[model samples]
Target: MVASQLGADGYDHTLGDFTAAAFTARAREEAGWLERLSTLEAATPDDAIDRDLVLSQLRGWVALASWPDWRRDPAVYLSAVFTSLFNPFQQRLKPEPELVAAAVSRLAEVPGVLAACRANLDPDLAAPLLVRRGLDQARTGRRFLTRTVPSMVRDPALSARLAEAAEPAARAFDELVAFLEGFACGGDWRMGERLYSTLLRERELLGYGAAELHEKGGAAWASLDERMREVARRAGGTADWRAVMESLMDDHPPTLEAMRAEYEAETRRVREFVRSRDLVTFPEGEKCLVLPSAEYTRPVAAVAHYLAPPPLTSSRTGVFFVPFTPDDFTEEEVRQRLRTNSRAQMPSIAAHETYPGHHWHLSHMAGNPRTVRKVFRTPYFSEGWALYVEKLLHEQGYFDTPATELAHLDCRVFRAARIVVDTALHCDDMSIEQAETFMATKASLTPGTARAEVSRYCAWPTQAPSYLTGALEIDRIRQAYQGSLKAFHDRIAGAGGLPLGLAERAVSRPGEGTPAG
Candidate 1:
C-alpha cells in the first residue's frame, strides 16, 4: 500500500521506505537504553527513580531520532510524528506524578542534546533523526516545566531535582541554536517536497495520500477566499481588504507589558465566566499558569498557546505560554496590540487554547482508557478541535463586544485566508509573492507577518488548511448531532467530548445523515 502511493517517481518509495527502515533501526538502537532504564527502576526501588525510568524511555526515543536540521526548526515534520506516536502515551501517563517527574527530568536534557548537535552534522545521515530529538527535548521540557514542575513540588526531593534540571536544560538551548544555524547553512531544498508530503500524511492520518491533500488544499483555498469576501462585505470593507486589516492593527495597538497583562487577565476572566456559566466542568487539583514564550519557539507561534497539562501522576500544571517579544514591536505599537487583542478576542483564544480547547481536550484524552489511541493523536483532530472551539465560542456569544466580535471575525478571516494561501503556494502553482499578497490582502496580515506566514506554508504544506478543514468537519458533526437531539446545549453536553479518532469515525461513518434541525 505504501509502495502504491509512492507511484512511478519512487521519491515517496525511497523516503517512506527509508523512514520505515530508519524507524526500525532507531527502535533497536534504543532497546539497550530502555533496558538499562528499566534495570535502574527495578534496582533503585523509588518512585522518583521509577518515574525517571519511564521518562528516560520516552526521551530516549526522542534523542535517538535527533538530527541537526530536524532539531533546529521541527514544527512541520518531527512535531507531527511525535504527536502521532508519543502523545497518546504521554496523555495516559499525565496523571501520574512519578512518571511526570521522570518525563520532566528527561525533557531537561534536551538543551544538552541540542548543544551536542554540532556543525559537522550530516543531513543525509542526520536529517531523518535530528528533529525527533529536538522535538523530544522541546516536548519534554515543555511538559516538565509547564505541566509537571508546579504540582510535584509537594515531593521535596522531586522538587529539588526539577529545580536543578532547568539550568542544564536551558543550556541545551544554545546547542539547539547552534544546530539550527548549521541547518540553515547546509540544508538543501531537494528534500522540501518529500518532507512536506510526509508531514501532511503523518499529521492528518488520512488515507487520501499526499497528492490528494495538495489537491484538496488547493480547492479549499479558492472556496475559503469566496467566503472571506462575503465576510469582508459584511464588515463594510471595500477599500482593499488588506488595508482594512492593517487599519485594525493600527487602531488598537498596546504596550508589550500591557498586552501581556491584558491577555493574562482576559484568560482568567474567560475561565471564570465559563465556570460560572456552566459552560463546562473543569477538574479539581488542576490549575492554569500563563508564561512568556521561549526564545526558540517565539518566531513562528502565535502570540500565545496552551501547553497541555502534565500527566495526572506528575506534579505539573498546564501552562499558557505567551512570549514577550518586546524587541519585535515598539512600545506604542505594542500598546495598540493590547487593545487589538483585547478581552473579546482574548477569551476565544483562551477557549481555544485552554478550557474547552487543546488543554481540556488533551487532558481528557490523556486520561482515557484507550492507551494506543491516547499515544497516537491526529493533528487534524487536535488542531481541528481548537479551531472549532474558536467558532463555537463566537457562536455561543463569547464575543459579545463589538471589538471582540471584530477580533473573532479577524481570526476567522485569517483562517479562511490560510486555506487559500496554504493551498495556492503548495499545489495551485502560486508563487511566494502571490501567496504573500493573498495573505496580506485576504487575511489582513501585515507585510512582516504575512511574509513569515508565507514562508511557513511554503516550508510546511497542508498545515494551514487543517484549521479550516478540521473546523468544518467538527461543525458539521455538531450540527448533525444537534439535529437529532433537538436541544443544542443538551446534545453537546451529553455527547461527551469526542476524541480525534472517534471524531473522524463519526464524520466518516456511512449513512450518517446531517443533523436534523
Candidate 2:
C-alpha cells in the first residue's frame, strides 16, 4: 500500500513524511511504509497502485509542510537543513554549527529507528516511530551535510539502490550509514575538490562538469559587466561604477518610520497597478506583511524578503521581512535603501515573490491534481520563474524612473555575478580571494558585501546559477510561443498560469506546437 504511493522513479522518498500526512489518516499513520511500498510497487508493475491519487496526496502533503515553522524539531527538520547546507547557493545569513551537529548525531541513530519501525509494523506503534525516524533523518541529514561531509560520504549511491531493491531494509540502513561515515572521514576540514564537485552536480542536475560551469559563469559575468557599463554611460554617470554606487549609499539613511511608510505606500500602489493592468488574478490566499529581520541575519539582510504564505490554510498574507539596521547606517543611508526599495519596484517584487512568483506558483501547484508535481519542486523552476518575472516587468515598462531602472539593473548584475562566483569557487579554478576581488571589481559591490556574497556562494554551490539558467530557459519558451501565436502574451495571462513541468515539456517537445491560452 505504501509502496504504490512512491510512483515509478521513487524520488518521492526524498520528500520525507510531512507531505504524505495530508492524504488519509492511513497515509499519515504509515507514511514511511507507504513510501517504501511505493518504491517496491514501482519496481513491480503488477502491483495494484493508484499513482494519480498518490500523487495528489503527495502534493497536499508538501503544500501543508512548505511553511518554515513546520520543521520545529531538530531531528525532523534534517532534510531541508542539509539541503540548504550542501548547496552553497542556499546558505542562511548565519551558520548554526551547534544545531547542525545535533542533527548529525541524530542521523547516526537512524538505523535503530528504522529497525524499531519495521518491528512494530502496526500503525499504533509503527507510524509514530516511522514519522519520528523520518524527521530525525531530515534534521540530522541537513546538519551533517551542511556542517560536514559524513552524511554524503556514508551512502552516496545507496539511496538510489534502496529505491530499487525490495525488502532488506536492514541492508539499506547499513549502506546509508557506511556511505555517510566514509564521506565524513574522506577529506580535510575544508571541503576538497571531490566533495565540492559531487555537491555541485547533485544540486544543479544540469549534467555540466564543474569546469564547464565555471567557464559559462565567466562568460555571463563579462556580458553583464559590459551591459552595466552601457547602462551607466547612458545615465551620464561621470564617476566609475564603484564610485557611483558608493555615492548612492549616503551617510544618513531614512528612519524606520519613513522606511515603513514608503514600503506601505508602494505596496498599495503596486497592488492597484497590477489589478488595473489586468495581470493574472491575485489569489485570495495571498497576504502581505512587514517585520523586522532577526538579529542573526542583520549583517547580510537585504532590504526585504517575501515570505510566501502557508499551503495547508489560506493565510493570504505574505511576509515582507525588513531588517532594522538602526546602528549600521545613518538616516540618509536608510533613505537611500528605502528609495531603492521603491513603490515602482514593489509591483515588480510583488510579482516575483507573491503574485506570479513563489506565492502564485506554490498556490497553483498545491491546488493541482498531481501530488508529485506539487511536492517535488525544483529550484531551477521556482527561482527561474521569479527571475523571469523581473525581466517580464522590465519588458512591460515597469521601471518608470531613473532610480527605479538603476535598482532593477543592480539586481540583474548581482544575480549574474552570483553565477560566476558560485561556479568559480566550487571548481577550484578561482580561490575565495579571487572570487571576492571579481565581485567587488565587476559587480560594483563593496568589500564587506563581496565577502559575504562569496561566502554564501562557496557554502551553497549550484544554487546561484539557477537564477540566470532558469530565466533564460523561460525566455526561450516565451519567445518560441510568441513566434507562433499572434497574442502570446495575452494567452499566457488568460491561461491563469502553466505548470512548470508542462511548460518545460511543451517547449522541449519538437512538434508540440506553441503554448496556448
Candidate 3:
C-alpha cells in the first residue's frame, strides 16, 4: 500500500486511494509491520523456512513505510505520486466492476493527492532534475485526466467528476512549479553508505552495504568485457565490439509492423522453448501480447517493454510495449530505434520480459495466500530473476546463431554497466554527466541511450544494479542446491517472489509447502 502511494511498482493495490491523508494514514499503519518485524527478528522460528519468509517480508513493509520521509522533498514525492496516479489510466486492465469502482474511487482522490503535494512538499529540498521531470509528468498526467480518462470511464457522473478534478490537479501542478522556482535545489539524492546499507537490509532483506555492491558491480563489468572480446573474435571482427554492435543495428527489421511481428513470433518461440525444456510450468489461459508503445510512455521505453499483470488483479494479461517511432522523427531516429532493437537483441529481451521471467514470476506471486508476499517484492528479486533467465536460456542453447548469442552477451554487459553506474550515481560517487559518459564508453550505449538510461537511473535508485546483483545471487543459490535447473526455478517460483536470501532457504529445503514442483 505504501509502495503504491510512493509510485513504486509491483504492488497490486486494490483500492484507488491516493489522497494526501492516505500518506499519513499509511505511515500510521506501518507501526504494525514494524512491530511484527521486531517480534519476528527477536525470536527465531523453529521452522527455518518460516523464519526467513516472515522476517524478509516484514522488512520490506518497513522500508516502504519510510519512503514518505525519504522523499519529503516536494519534487521527488510529486514525481512518484503523479507517475503512480497515471498508471491505471495509462495501461489496459480487465474491465471488471470492482476495478471500475476502484478507478472511480481513485479519480475522487486525484485532487486531494495533488493538494497533499501542495501541503507536504518542501520545494527547497528538491533536486532540479526531479522538479523538471515532475513538471513533465504533471503536464502529461493533466492531459491524461482531462483528455484521455473521460472516454475510458463511459460513466456520465464519473466523467463529470473527472472534469471537476482536472482543474485542481492542474492548479496543484502549477503551484508546485511556482514554489520550486523560489529556491535553488540543493538536496542530496545520494543514498550514501549508511542509508543505502539500511535500505539494502530492509528492502532487499540483504546485509551487504554499498561498498560490497560496488565490488560486485565492478567484477560484473570486468567479466562482461572479457566475454564481449571473445564474442568479437568469434564474429571475425576487430576487438571493437562497439563497431560490431553498430553493424548489427543496420540489420534491424525495416518497418514497425515487421518489428511487432518479429517480437510476436520471437515471444512464441520463447514460450515454446521454456515448455519444451520443462524450464517452468506454463499455466493455461495466460497470454502475452505485443503492441505499440503509447505516445505518453515512448520517452521512457526506448526499445520494447512488458506490462506484467497485477498479481492481485486476475483480469489482466501481459502486454509487451514495442516502440512506436512517431512519423515526425527524423529518418536517423527511426533507424537508430530499430537498430538498438535488432534481431539479435529480440530473443533476450523477449525472454527477460516474458517466459520464465517477469510475467511468469508475477503469475505465481499473485497466488500466494499472504498479502505481504504478493505486494512487497523488491526490484532485486524481479529484475534478477529476469536476467537469471537470460543466462539460463543461453546455457540451454536457446539462441539460434552466433550473432544472436553475442546479442545475449551484450545484454549482460549492458546490465553490468548499469550495476557499476547505478551505484556511483546513487552514492554521489559520480555526477550525472560522468555517469552518462561512463556508460557510453564502457558499455557501448549510444550517447542518446546513455542519457535516457541515466535519467531513468536518477528516477529509480537501486533498481538498475539489481539485474546483475540479482542474477548473480540466483545463480549462486542454484549452484548450492543439488537439483535440476527446472527444479531450482520451480522452487523459487513456488516460494513467491522473495529476496534471494529467503528464496535460497525456500529452494534448499524440500519438505515445506513451498517446495519445487
Candidate 4:
C-alpha cells in the first residue's frame, strides 16, 4: 500500500491485505530476505553500508512483528485505504485514464480491506486515544470519498464509475467509525520502558537508555531556556523569554493568505542564502514547492508536512505543505494558527523544511545509487539534518537579529522539551493532559497546537525525541570531521539516510577503521 501511494511501478492498482495470514506471510518474506542479505559479500564500502542498513531494517521489522499492531491499530488499515485511493490523484504520475482505473480498482477493494481490519482488531485491546484518532481520520476519509473524490475525475464515465465505487467505500468507513466509537478502549498506548529502550538501542543504535534520554533532554531544556532569556534581554531589554515569545506572535500576518505568501518569499530567500554561502550543491532537476496541506491530510498534519520526491517516479518536485485555516474557523481560531506560524519564525521554518533542510537532504538521498539506503531512512538523519542546519545557519549569521535569534532558540527549546515529554509519556507515566501542559509551557505553543503535538507523540513513541537527539548526534559527528562545512554536508548527504552510527562510519577517514556489515 505504501509503495502504491509513492507511485512505485506495478503497485498502484492494489490495496494491502490486512488479514492474519498476510501478516505472517510478510514476516516470512522478511526473514527470507534477511537470510539472503547475510550471505552476500559486500565488494565495496558503499555496498557494505547498504548491507548493514538492510540487515538492521529487517531485524527491526522482524522484532516489531511480535507486537501485532494489525490486531490493535485500526489506523493502519484506514490510512492504507486513504493513501491508496488519494495518492493517484494527488501525484498524477500516470495518464488520467490509468490513474482513474487504478483508483477505482483500489476503491473496489476498500470494503474487503476494512472488513479484514474489523476481523483482525481486538476490541478489548484498542487504545482510546488511537481509537479517537482513527475516528477523526475515518470521518475525513469518508468526506474525501463522497465529497472530494468524484471532482478529481475528468471523464464523465470515469467520474460515474468513481462515484459508484466511492459509495461502498464511504459506507465502509462509516461502519468502521461506528465500530471504533463503541470500542472497549482498555489497552495502554505507552511503549513502556523496556520496549522503548530496546528500540533506541537496537533500531536507532543509540548509546543511551530512556532514563539517560530524559535526563539529557531535561538539561538541554534548561540550557536552551536560559539562552532564550539572554536573547530576549537583547531583543527587548528584558530577561523574560516568555514575554518575548508572546510579543513575536503579535507581529504575524493578519490573514492566512499573507502568511502563505510570506512562506513562499522566505523559501526563495533561504535558497539564495544557501547558494551564495556555498553551503551545499543542489541536486540536478530538483525543486521544492510551497503549498497548502491537502484536505485529507489536515486531520493529523496540523502544522507542516514535507512530501519527499517519489522514489520510483521520475518527478523530482518535493512539496512543503503549510496548514491552511478552514473556512469555518472563528477569528480567535485563526489568530491562534497565525501566532503559531508568526513572521518572526518564517526564516527558521523555511530553513528547516526546504533549502538546506528536509527538501535538500532528501533530494540528495533520493539520488543515492543504493536502493536500500533510499528505502530505509531514520528520522535520526532526516529530522536531525534539518535541525542541525538551523543551528548551522544561525552560526553563519543568517538569523542575526535579536528577535529572529530568539525565535530559533525557542524552536530548539521546543525540540528539547519533546525529548523530555516523549520519554516521560512512555517511561515516566506522564498523562496525555500533563504532557500537553508541559509542551505548552516549555515550548510556548498555543493550547491547540500543544494538544496536536502531544497526540502525535502518543501514537509515535521515540519519534519526538529524534529531532533533538539526532541533531545533537550530527553535531558531534561534525566536530570530528576534517573538512569544510559544505564538504561535511555533502559527505553526509552522499551517505543517504543511514543511521547516524553507520553515517559516522561512512564519513570516516582512511585510517579510522570503518566497520563491516
Candidate 5:
C-alpha cells in the first residue's frame, strides 16, 4: 500500500509476496540496484549527496537480508499488515471507491500473508516479549478489521464489501494470536554489538559506534537531569524534578476533547510563533490537522503522532493524532492517560510533533523535487529535527513558564534515557525487564508506558536512539554555523531529511538547494 501511494506502480491492488523466496529475490534485486548506483557519477554537489543517501539506504537493505527479520520477528508481519492497510485510509490520496477497493483487496490477502509469516517465523528465534507484543497487536488488528474498517467507508456497497473482506482477515489475526499464545520464544532480542555497530556506522552514516552512542546518551542524560533539577527548583522552589513533573500533570484538561483542543490551539500558536520569528520556511500548500488516533493505531499510539502526507501526492497536509482515552479504560487509567498528556506538556509536544518539528520539517521534505529525499528519510534526520527544534524553542524562550520548562526538560531527559536504554537493549547490556525498570525509574515513565517503550526498542533496534542521536549531531552542526539561526534552520530543513552526515555537508555549503531529481 505504501509503495502504491509512493508511485511504485502496480502494488495498489494486492499485497506483495512475503515468502522467503520472495524476500531473497527482493534482497538480490536491491543489491543489483546498489551496484548500479555505485557506477553513477554525480554531476553536482547535491547529486553527490543524493547518491550517498541512496547508497546508504541500499546498503541497509542489502545488509538486513543476512539478518532476516521476517524469520525472527512476528511484529514485522503485523507492522506490514497495519501500515499497508491503515495508510490508505489515513492518507486518502485516492477516491473513496478506489481506497475501499484497495483495502478490500489487501484484506483478502491477509490470510496468505499470515500463513507465510507462520512458515517463515522460527519459534526458537522469536523473543517472548516480541511474540507477546505481536499477540497484543494481532488482537488489536482483529478489532480494527471487524469494527473500525466497516465504519470508515460512506457508500453502503463499498462498506459492505470491506466488511465482507474483513471477516476472514479478522479470523487470520485470531489464528496469529492463538499461534503466538501457545509458543515459547527461545531467541534473544539483542541484535548483538556488531550488527548494532554496523547499523550505526553503515546504515545511519554516523561517525561513531553503538558504544559511543551509549556513552553520549549517558552524558546527555546527566546534563538534562541537572537541567531538570534546576528548573524544578525554579518552578516550585523544589529541586525535586520528579515531584514537580508529577504536579504539572494534575493541571491537565478535564476531558480528552478539551485536551485535543489544547493540542490544536498549541499547534496553531506555535505555527504563528514560527512565522513571526521567521523560523524555517513552510512548503507551499502545507497544513496540519489535529485529530484523534485512528482505532487501529491506538494499540501502539504515542500521546502524539505526526502522520506525514504521501510525497507522491500534491497534498502537504499532516495529521497530528492525539489518542483519546479509551472507553474501556478504568477511571484511574483514563486519568493516567490524561495526566501523561498534561496541559503544561502539550506545547512542547505541539512544538515537537507539529510546528517547527515534524509537520514543518516534513512538509519541506515532502516538497523536495528529488524522490530519494522525499522517500528514504532516516529517523536520524526526521526524529532528530523534531527533537532538535524542541530545544531550539526552549532556548528561544518558547517554554517561558517554569512549569513548561520543567515539562520540556522532562521530555529531553526521557529522550536521553532512550539513548541509554536503546543501546543497552540492542548491545546485550540490558534485559527487557531491566530496560523497563530503567525507563520507569530513570525516565519516570509509568510501568505500562515503560514496558511499551522497551517493547518498541526490542522490535526496532537503533530507532529509539535516533531521537537524541540525531538532535545531538544537529546541535554539533549548529554550534559551528556562521549564519543567523533562522538561516541555519532553513539550510538544514532544505537538506530534506538526508542522513545527518549529508545534512552537515549541505549546511556548510552556501546556496545549496535540494538535489535535482
Candidate 6:
C-alpha cells in the first residue's frame, strides 16, 4: 500500500516493492479492509488472540496514511527510502526482462514521488538534524538513477530512458529542498510519551512504558559496566576500559580487505561453533556471506546490515552487508572503522550478524513454510533475537577470549545505552548532540558514527530500544519455558519473526500463531 500510494521515498522502509501512482485509491481500500476486519472480529472475537498481531500490523498500515511523523521532514523519511536501490532491495528476484522492466518503472518514478512529497509534505516539521543529510540522499538518488540504475538495464533504449529521467528527479530534489526550507528547526520531530505509549500498546502490544524502559536501560547499562570491569580485571589488573579498548583496536587486521578476509574466515569459525555447541539448529543448504554495502546503501548502513531472503519471492539466499571499504575512506576514517572492526569487535559482531544471530534466525525463518510467519515482520523481535544471541553466545562461552568477552559486554552496553538515548530523545530531555555524546562516551563509538546513529534515532524515534527490550522479553519467555536451551531456541524459531508480545503468546499457546512482545 505504501508503494502504491506514497512511493518508496517516504517514512516506512519495509513496505516498498514496486512504486505506483502518487495519488492512490488505497485509502478507501484500506478503510474497506478495516471494516471487514471489524466485522470478522465482532463475529469471532475469540480469534483476537490469534489475529491480534496481524490486525495490529494492518492497522499500522492504515494509521501510516495519517501518521504525523511524516509531516516532520518528509525529505528525511525520503532519505531512508531513497538510500537503497530498487533492484537489490529486490535482490532475490530473478533478472527476467519483465521483472527488470517493472523495477525500472519504479526507479523512473523517483521524480514523481518527490513531486508528490513536495506537493503534500508539511515543511514545518522537517527535522533540522536530518534536512542536510536528507537532501544529500536526494542528490545521491540522482546519481543512482543516472549512473547505477541505468547501468543495470540490459536494453539500450531503456537505459537511455532511465538516464533521461534523472534530470526531472534532480529537479524534484531541488523542489524538496525548497519545501524543506520552511522548517528552520527540523529536529522538532519528537514522538512524545503519549504517542510512544500508544504505539507500544496498540501497534506492538509491548507492555512497558517509555519511562519503565528508560529505567531498565539505565539498570542494564550499570550492570554491563560492572561486568566489563570484571572482565577487565581478568584481562589485566585495571578496569580502565578505555586503555584495554584502545589496545584491542590495535590488534585488528591492517587494511579493510584484510578486515573483510578475517570476517569471512570468522564466519566459518562462528558457524562451526554453533554446530559444535548445539546452541541452536543451523539451517541446511542456506547460504550467507559478507559483502560490501551497495553504493546506495552506504550512506545509511554505516556498520552492518542483514538482508533477509525476499518473502514469497524466489530469492532464498541472504546477504550480510558490512561497511568496510577502505579505498573510498581516508586513513584516519579507515582506522576508526577498524577500531569498530577490532579483534574484539569482529567475532562478537559475527555472532550477532551471522551464525546464531540475524543470518541464522532469518535463514531458519525463511525455511519455515508458514505464510503468517513469512509476513508481519517487526524490528523488536528481529533485533532482539540478534542481541539476545549475542548474550547467549557469551554465556555459552562462544566468546571465550578476554577481548572478545569485553566486546560482547560492550555490545550489551551499547544496546542498553540505546534505550536511554531513544527514550530521552523522544520525551524531550535529550538533544541529538547529547545523545551522540552519551553514545560515543558510553558505548565506545567514534563521534562521527555516533552522530549518524543519533540522526537515525531522530528519524526513527521509538525503534532504538527494541534491541534490549526484545531481548529482555525473550529472556523472560526463556525462563518460563522450562526446556533445554535448544528447545527454548526452537520455540523462538517456531514463533517465527514476530513481535515479542505475540511470540510470548505463541509460547504460552503453542501451535496457535507466531508471537512477539
Give the TM-scores of the predictions, in the order they appear.
0.62, 0.57, 0.85, 0.94, 0.95, 0.86
> Which candidate tops TM-score?
5
Q: Sort every candidate by lDDT, greatest first.
A: 5, 4, 6, 3, 1, 2
Tens-digit lDDT string for candidate 3 (45-113): 214445555666556546655445334444444544444444555454534343345555555555555
Model 2 ranges with Cα > 4 A deviation: 1-207, 251-253, 299-303, 325-351, 482-503, 506-517
Worst lDDT run of 10 residues, candidate 6, spans 4-13
Q: 141-258 in candidate 5: lDDT tens per residue? A: 7778877877778788888888888999999989988888887769878888888888888889998999999999999999988888888899988988888788888988888888
Q: Write the per-residue lDDT of candidate 6 for residues 64-154, one digit (tens) a residue.
A: 5555444455553464335434434345244445544454555556565665556555555555665655654554555666777667676
Name the better of 1 and 5 by lDDT.
5
Candidate 1 residue-wise lDDT at 494: 20
Q: What ordering of candidates by TM-score runs from best to worst?
A: 5, 4, 6, 3, 1, 2
Report lDDT per candidate. Answer: 0.49, 0.46, 0.68, 0.82, 0.83, 0.69
The residue-by-residue lDDT of candidate 1 on 1-517, one tens digit each, is: 1221111222211212223344456566666666555545333222332234244334434443432233234443323322322332233333345433544544544443333344334454443233433443343433444334434455556555555655565455444544554453334222233434544443343445445655554565556555545544544455234444444455532555565676667667767766666654455455666666544344454356666643323323566766454345565544543544545456667777776667655654444332323333445656777777777777667877554556566676677677666655554467778878877676555565676577666555566767666776667666666233223322232222333334534333321211211
| Candidate maximizing lDDT | 5
Off by over 4 Å in 6: 1-50, 58-67, 75-84, 88-92, 150-187, 324-329, 512-517
Model 2 C-alpha lDDT versus the unseen true structure: 0.46
| Model 5 misplaced regions, further than 4 Å | 5-9, 325-328, 515-517
Off by over 4 Å in 4: 35-41, 153-160, 325-329, 509-517
Q: Count clashing residue pairs per candidate.
A: 44, 51, 0, 0, 0, 17
Error of 2 at 322 (Å): 2.1
TM-score of 6: 0.86
Q: Give candidates' CA RMSD values in order.
A: 11.8, 14.6, 4.2, 3.0, 2.1, 4.6
